[model samples]
Target: MAKQAVIYKTEAGEREILRRYEEILAGWPVPAGRHHVPTREGDTFVLVSGPEDAPPLVLLHGSGSNAAMWAGDVAAWARHFRVHAVDMIGEPGLSARSRPPLDSTAYADWLDDVLDHFGLDSAAFTGASLGGWLALDYAIRRPRRVDRLAVLCPGGVGRQKFGFLFKVALYRPFGAWGLRRSIKAVAGVDPGDTPEVADYLTLMFTHFQPRRDRLPVFSDEALRGLAMPVKVIVGARDAMFDSAETARRVENTVPHAEVTVLPDVAHSIIGQTQPIMDFLTR
Candidate 1:
């Protein structure tokens, strides 16, 4: 039988990506320890840090990114909470490359395994982009396990604009330069500003073959059903979706959800550490 295929375009590409991954992780600013949490699906890789007794906070990265992407915010977050930065399964991280069906509860189940492994009954959850969608999904399915929820430019809550897809496709043929331009347009900041994150995303985009799963939007019923406090932040200038519209939907559907639309920010909304921390702690 042929060897099982992974997300990368080729085995060599996977090796190269893994090499860069370790290099980026080694340069993590804050002190962290690696934990290869065993789950039913596979071994979930997590970066554990912060105080032993501090309130727990789980961090999930956007698509094509990994736990290392949280380097910018982990230090401050770790100060107030015990941080668990998880390299989402099947992404460009140390976690097993088992791509679970997006529409099913596979992700929720996998996360359940992770939380159980950590001996955590519940924890505050924060996720970016695709990770945000995952967090929301889990929270909706297992509300009692999520003490609080905060999301950054999450999908599944609003209509994804075709304009975003057109722009991304338009830039693909131009290679890395065009890809970087597209990324800048959506992410709102120059990739050069954060060279490590830029490099990692670029590498993953160049090498990895992302899953072609369609994410479903969360219904008003689901959003309104959330029992815990929910907070949402989006980039006013986000090209991927109508950030204002997203905020509106979240605000209207989830009456109690605190929504903030940051001016001049894009899909890759940054500079939200303080706002999210305030919400999480408050």
Candidate 2:
């Protein structure tokens, strides 16, 4: 038989792929490293925790970040839950996408496939930044599949007056790079050494691919579709968009939902392991 075609990469792309994969592996916070497994969505990668039979919880990394942001909390939570930290499909890290999820519904459906592959009927979800946006939208689309939704400093909300050129800057080829700058621009704080924050932004821009054609929930007005448990956490010092406005939207949409504004916290709430734990535990 002829040699099988190398569909995963071209020869020149091997080094880049290897380096990126190494970064992905090294970026994780939990021990026993990462394990590769194929899911209906694609080759969904996971960082395992606790026992196999434990309650499953999915951790969604924010924009420009890998699953490693959940590092600190997983080891602690795994005692009660089988933590599965996922690299968002098509964005970056180890999610091998045959086709990128193209829109809000598609992303939701694809994520459902991932959950299904693990035989999980429902899970506790946590996401940050762009991941937060995805988590909320996913819960809205598939309310029964998620038990509780936690979003930290999520994006895709509000109508802000922006400098015309500045608005266009978000769409450039180097958008993730601009994304990091934009985040810094929004946070109003110096980017301190907050563990994986810088690495998160770097991978997001350089490795993760955003499908611009994909319509995000930010465009949608109806949040009533999501009836399951939902929680919104906005950083008091977020350099991102209007945190209070986003929090109010979740509260209004979910009705009787939990909303928290973290004081002295920046956009990377995942870095604040204890607060995240207390929120999830409660």
Candidate 3:
């Protein structure tokens, strides 16, 4: 028998992380419904919010995170669009641990199932980091199905940096303090997060094994083929990816793409609620 893929270090750790995840879901900030949609990959978890009549908008979170990352943005986004925050498979969420090959059509097929389940022929997409890569891959491979695309600090467009890995290695021996520093440095965010947010991040990284494979950068032809309205928001000081390169490429290849490079931001681009909504709605 094939050994089941284990995302958490131990069974107990998985349970605790899930317990905390559920706690966050309990206060999802809007009336929401949860679904475990079946797909070829495995059962995928989705947290649905907003009015049923609203236009469908799919939200994909970054690696080492889940749908819960949308807590602060959901309320506002829900008012405008029916939001389906997906827990990407193999991540730390309730999704299946079946990580298909990144260099294949498996993820696009998985998303096809997800959209089919939602009765959506197409939907607007917004993603961060790894999720951004997923959205871009899908948008490129299945352009007809993506009404619009907006990515924040997305991968695949920029060159993925490996220097953070060295920094992480250097800090691992320092214990929790080092972990916190690593998170701050890599995320390019200040260490002033609320206690709840800080605690949750610590819990996630402690147990979850993040994907180590490099993201496949999109070719210029693939990017130029994007027919849908595209918006790319990147941080100038991103530690994980070359944000400037991302901005330059997207701007040059997809001439119609609206790219924004925040001068002071890093990999973690927050407070984009209004901007993203405007792009999606406009």
Candidate 4:
């Protein structure tokens, strides 16, 4: 008999993953804050945080995604600091987009408003891909508001090298279809239900409303003038930002920035718990 490749995949596998995510989120225990933030400029949504007075660690997720992406890490983060996971305006998240045709400055300003609404003056930021770019943009425009930053496998500029599936996901919201596949790709779901993942996508996650993930809105003047302590981590296998040249391109622009490329990882490092925790504590 001929050897067979592991092309043995099916829609059933996706449905199974979806079922498990729902179960996991429902049963898994974690530190959670149930609160809604109302802002006049943009849409208001529930903001989840851990701890009341711990140093605020703000996390911004990329497009086609929401705060729930952190479902895998919230409970653990509570041990160290107050973790604030935000749903961006204009993106497919819990936050409603007040208006469209938004620009980079507008996006940054909106983020500032969210920070203000929560009474956060200074915070540590960790973003992934598009979220990473947003984090740097915020540090650049409002340096005084940020304490520290860590951007994981960010996207934007001509620097982002994307994979086939990634390019497709960014293209459509497929909703349930997208969610099921996303879980399969992002996490190492042992044989179990992922309720935590599914609820976040269907319930808390926003795509039905006016805002979807914020599209790139950077002006050279806006992105280039930042002078803040920022750390950028890229994966060696990151089809987007996969080379030293790619890292250097971003490094050369920021005045005070550190870039690290981990060999065995991919853009999914944002979900990889350990590095992010270590970076924040340091």
Best by TM-score: 3
Query: Model 3 compared with the native: what TM-score?
Result: 0.97
What lDDT, from 0 to 1, does candidate 3 have?
0.91
Expressed as tens digits, the lDDT of each residue in 1-282 for candidate 3 is 112366888888899999999999998899999999998888999999999999999999999899988999999999999999999999999988988778999899999999999899999999999999999999999998999999999999889999998888988999877887888888864557655666677788898888878899999999999989999999998999999899999989999999998999988888999999999999
Model number with the top lDDT: 3
Candidate 4: Cα lDDT at 41: 47
TM-score of each model, in listed order: 0.94, 0.74, 0.97, 0.68
Residues 1-282 of candidate 2: C-alpha lDDT, one tens digit per residue: 111222333444444644755765665545543666555556667777768787778888864445656666776777777888887765446666444443536667768777777788888898887787788777767778888777778766532223433633664555655655554555432346542455455444444444433235454355767676677777776655567777777777667677888777755564556665666667
Q: Show how many residue pairs clash in every candidate, following the order shown.
A: 0, 5, 0, 17
What is the TM-score (0 to 1) of candidate 4? 0.68
Clashing pairs in 3: none
Q: After superposition, how far is residue 136 of candidate 2 from its true place, in Å?
A: 1.4
Report clash pairs, candidate 1.
none
Model 3 vs truth, CA RMSD = 1.4
| lDDT-superior candidate, 1 or 3 | 3
lDDT of each: 0.85, 0.63, 0.91, 0.61
Query: Alpha carbon lDDT of residue 157, candidate 3?
Result: 87
